[model samples]
Target chain A: MDNLKTKHFTFQLKDLEISVELIEELARIDDSMPEYSRFLKEEIDSTLSLSQIEGGYTILPAQLDQNTIHIGDHCFNVGKSIANKFTNSTHIAIFTCTTGPLISDRLKELNSQGLILEAYLIDLLGSVMVEKAMDKLQAIIEAECTSKGVNITNRYSPGYMNWDVKEQKDLFAFLPENFCGIKLNESCLMTPVKSVSGFIGIGEKVRFIKHACQSCNSTNCLYRNSKNHC
Target chain B: MEKLFEQLAYCIEFGKINKQSPYPPNMKDQEGAGELTGQLLDQGVSADDILQKALIVGMERVGVKFRENKVFVPQVLMSAKAMDAAMIQLKPHFANNPGSQKGTFIIGTVEGDLHDIGKNLVSMMVEGNGYEVIDLGTNVKAEVFIEAAEKNPKAVIGLSALLTTTMNNMEKITIAIKKHNKNTTVCVGGAPVNQEFCERIGADNYSPDPQGTVEFLNRTVA
Candidate 1:
């Protein structure tokens, strides 16, 4: 089950079908935004067309030695946070997802016009959209691994665990460039800015915790308290 | 007629662009900020009064509401658009009557950060509060801030950064601004910044939200 590569798979949930209800819930809208329901729906429809969802993953066999996880001849010196996460995992799935550049252009236009709130809402939507795509990708991966008698653990990203964000370059090396029309800059930040890149663990009888938000420093995140993960 | 200013303020607060705008459902087809400001000015109301009374007052209400989380981002954007509509009506008056300036506010997102939502929010709120805002835009270098301060000595410089990595540049910008002119006030804010970081970086002030920034300007820069 190690080094399994599942590339070029499409999404099940129609990208636009990601409920506006979920976006609203994530944005924490209340009664104060008069007529915002209609406004958000319009923006979502416009922004959804602008979004280009792309995701892919390749499985790699890993050998965890104390705190370091060696996969496909590359070693990750993850800290205690991630080391404990992959404890029962036998394989690792490296993944990346993005909503492409359109959302970013929309955000820029909103900001330049001093439409702060509109920009902020769209930014939240971008996160939700990317996550929505990732959720579908995860579901497919789960189904694939399930038939193989392997259990997949929760997904993990750098900048959370002691896994340094500098390691983002490492993940990009294995995936095809423009794998999802996403690219990394010198700073390791994915272009289009609304992209997500991370890894998931696969194992048998492994316990998976969706997210350890309580331990995360980003308390202001909209999704921090929702969906049992950050 | 006296209530024209009040009506203008209400229009601005509710994001009424014009009688044609269908927003704020209840206010549909009613006079909006644009129409109200034009009518008030034509009726001989002073631009200063309209600006200081209606536009500023309206933004203050929204700012307070935003601080209380009573209004979210979309609500604020509508209000800002309404304010812009009103500003268009009064732009000519203010252009010729520059004495109505409250003070200058030069703002930008710190270098290495492309994020500007917070910076733009503060810019609109501050502008609505009556400052002659000179927005430097995002990824602004410390030198640009200092240069702008040199050009407008009375200006209070605002530095914004949404990323933790870029937040570090706040200290450098603050130090540069202070070194160039120690009396020039430097305000900082964003998700990753706090009052402690502000003090550690030698910034003069820090606010968690845009309204607090306006209130800070009111108490200090005003």
Candidate 2:
């Protein structure tokens, strides 16, 4: 079974917003949490999901540096090095989000399980949306790069080591409303539970970012986020 | 009858937590696992019978589906939720009945990583399979795991990483756990980890999904 499937959805990015009740609900969950340390996480997750629906984080296609470039802001940047490496190279990535209305229903059902369910659904929604957005962004990048005689290599994003996350501000500088409503918190993270920031490299040579799998060093990085396999 | 068990498994597998849950609309308003399990218990079915015979069976199937990508997080979360709801009614039976657990399992998202969906899924699956789970939560340090292992001397450890960057911490924590207790079994999973990476980190096992983890734990305890 392939965990990765090609999902296409056309969503109106402007329709997303932060839900105040979600924050309160998350806070209520926090107060009852068995583990105090995880309180902040529960709250952040709730806030992120609400933010994602509010439409703050987004990506766009633009002509950058004589290349068809994909730009994202207020979304997740895995690392700085990965982001820089993409900028210096060429690859095609599709930037899109889940375009269906089933998210609210899905989230509602998940919420019945517990507050953590709400937070999780929101996070999953954000990630799924980001993945979908990336797919759309990839198609645009590929079409643009192909016409320019540049074969795409691979995709990369910010938040990786060596790629300053502070650039999140700069990455969104060109977009109106900071690229679809996703704004930087004080720490430079997207407010929406599901958002991402990155770029796709388009070039003639095949340059897969060495950061994925064992070839990359994730353990040593100070800015590491999410204890996940991917 | 076996039909009820089949229906119960479908509820757990599709994530039909209860009648009120609106997901997977086909099951909407139907008798959910909560009601069914409660009904089964009220009918004099042993709690152990329900757990091993129904809840565990349902959860195990979903875990494999999740690992194989036949189902995604949303679907699996529903299954876990269904299993959890059913477990709430069966906790007393677990306590009343001894020698039911496979063993203790300590799980957490590695240090510097904050994601918990994958880890939580594993926790529910392990718990559903009759293992006592100590979930350390996310952003856990190597020392935290070691501390847990020290407390539960017979416990096995599972490490989860969602980001490429955080996967690095898996090795460090594995090394630390092994350093303190060489006998400690370490298993790793997440989007970026695999068996090859597991061996490279010197961890004892790597399972692609929660069911795999359950099977491994069962073997060890057996």
Candidate 3:
């Protein structure tokens, strides 16, 4: 039964709108010949698949006694390792807030076309990965709250509906190594192409509702926000 | 007649484009939608009869398959491409009759989102369903959408975003459009977007796939 459940949990790579041009560019970045375009096409032809088990999930496995929780040993240890690799590490700060950096230069690019590249499917893939990772983390955190007999609120992250992006630093500070394998570049991006760090509020006042993309202030939200709720 | 329609629908369902266009591995050098459609036209079939009876019938099946994940993007893209090939030959008749299209649809990726594969797929599907789609390209701002909506009052608006960061921008634009014209129906989509986001932002509709979007537009216009 458990084996069947695990197999059922396997998720196909959800559609990440990829352009023919970007596939070509990715091929170039790999230093493959232009004929490699055919290879890229073939890969695109074959949809990408990812699973929750591959994403990895862990329970908080403990309880928080206070509303204002600080980055303690385990989370700090993980975050510290992440911070060390980032440039301009001194200015990198962490906080506990709802809003974080939702948009950044890390998402946009400049090219010879004189037009800024507005979005990338790779970025979308990363966003989807982060969202699924967050879901796994939420499962763990929620379980912790339930085991402790506390009603938790929504998993709020920086750059949420009304939350400001500036609070990303605070969220980073709370996590271990700013997230195990994820790093914040000078421009404030979590690397590894697949990672997320956010906090789930544990209280009675936390709004529990279906995630709605239209309700959020971030209209152009790409990560699994309210967009997936419906 | 039903047998002929079935073959044409099969050609479209499996993405058989013509006698020469090779794809799908199984249907090499087979008669595609193009030839079948042409043959139907030469048989004194009304343009509307062929479109409604044959082309749209197959596409609706394709749409349902796409929605159920029975097919993926590449297959759908191929189907859309094949649909376009057939439409090219049918377009002249539509040119003769201006009322052929159900309505106009304006689509784009909201500002901060450069992704267009979703928008393009929707455009192709909507076009396949015989609606004229004015693709505004990507990274479009609220004002651009408002302007386009004002210009094409009959057209449905579609906004797409492929990044979580840009999802916020989709909301802002949706709000801005409603503020300008409350009646404008904005359809929100993308991999991350769902119906929940649509209601939250006050958009009229949300679709997980191109087929749903077409159905929404069809129901609205119907």
Candidate 4:
């Protein structure tokens, strides 16, 4: 605990150059539908203009005993799916990232105005942006670990892969109060709506798996359905 | 009249809102659902016919395409918008003829869940299919659903929850609705919900997509 350090990062909209191609693939639109493709591009630009991305992670010494991950004095029952992936992990990076509240506020406004299509496109863009920001954060963590000759595993969130979402409380305990300006409600849902939080394993024996969807049983997962595009 | 209905259905399927709507570039400058519906009404076609013969046909095609993965959310939303444009012209008729709807549907996201995109999509699809929809919005409680069900005695109740944690709330809501009225039909859906969870919670049905829900309602109520 004495050597553990928390690092925070703020990214401008320019930092996350979310590609239009990726957005189209996720939204299932293509150049053939030029009208919708153009609409999505416009909304993406507007959403990015309103987005304020922020993220941070705190690396802590961890010990895995079966399905339980012991970090400091807290133990997270992160379920078998995640525990199996982190079996060789010697440390864990707890992270949180958000695309601020403006995009959500704009979505509400669009919905109120009966622009459901535009609002839906913006919502999809927000999801893509926040995940892109997390990807950037992960790259930073990876580079730092690479410098130290430590490998990282694929990130896991509390709500996915059969892991009990209630463990979000335990996961948040590793971060400072309101880390990245994200707050968990009683139901463990993050506010600002487009925020994401999770853990990434760090150690020499840990390995990053590109597609965890094959082993995961949560078939209705949005990420699983869009992982190819992601 | 049949030609007009076919044209209107095509407009709804391709998402042509009006003569000015630039979608489905091939249909550009042609009168869309908005114009065609108005013409049908002025030509003495019944609102019920427009809904039954045109709007529902168009929406059903879109729903099937969505189920088959030939179309996605944005495309479906465009179709919904076109449906809305046509439905707007028939609003007065529906108001005067309350029994014109196929049936009533009550839907909401369970308590502790604020996600509504999936719920909204379901609502649009159901409404487009001629059901009178009563949307309870997000973070709705069991009592609210029971109350709405009590008012619309024959309405089918639909519960949605996007979070694994709120899946418990969906179960609690389902149990409460069933306890209030043992005969009431309850349908549950969401990203985290499935057939097993639906059966475990005693929910009457589970649909992975909006089309399945529409098909279930068609089978159950029709």
TM-scores of the models, in the order given: 0.84, 0.60, 0.56, 0.93
Residue by residue across A1-230, what tens digits does model 1's lDDT show?
Answer: 32345585544334647666676666665444444566668876664565567788988788787787888767887777788878888888888887778788888788677666667778887788788888888887889899999998888876664677668878777787667777775446677788778878898966787675677677456677344344
- Taking the tens digit of each residue's C-alpha lDDT, what string does model 2 give over A1-230? 11222223333333333233332342232232223234334533443334333222222333334322344333333344454454545333432223233343445455455755555635544554455455555565566667877766455545444455555555555434434445554345453435565555665653555445454544422112223434
lDDT of 2 by residue, B76-179 (tens): 66677788888899888878875666688999998766666778888988987777899998778999999999999988999998765667789988998898
How many clashes does each candidate structure show, in the order listed? 4, 63, 53, 0
Give chain A TM for each model in order. 0.88, 0.48, 0.46, 0.90
Predicted candidate 3 versus true structure: per-residue lDDT over A1-230, tens digit per residue: 11211101122334334455544332222221112345434434552322222222222322232222333342222232122222121111221211112222333331122121123333443454445545544555556556866654455444454444444554554444523344554323344434444444454333445465555555345432221243
Best by TM-score: 4
Q: Give one digit per residue, the lDDT tens place, for model 4 in B1-222.
A: 899999999988888889988787888888999999999999999999999999999999999998888887878988999999999989899999999999999999999888999999999999999999999999999999999999999999999999988999999999999999999999999988999999999999999999999999999996
In DockQ terms, which candidate is top? 4
Clashes of 2: 63
What fraction of the true interface contacts does model 3 reproduce?
0.00
- Candidate 1 segments exceeding 4 Å error: A1-16, A24-51, A62-85, A108-122, A161-179, A212-217, A224-230
* Residue A136 error, candidate 3, Å: 26
The CAPRI quality class of candidate 1 comes to acceptable
Which candidate leads in lDDT? 4
Candidate 1 at B43: error in angstroms? 2.6
Give the fraction of reference interface contacts each candidate recovers: 0.18, 0.03, 0.00, 0.59
lDDT of candidate model 2 versus the reference: 0.63
In candidate 4, which residue pairs get closer than 3 Å at backbone N, Cα or C atoms, i.e. clash? Answer: none
Instruction: For each candidate, report its DockQ versus the true two-chain complex.
Output: 0.27, 0.03, 0.02, 0.61
Clashing pairs in 1: A3-A59, A3-A60, A3-A61, A4-A59
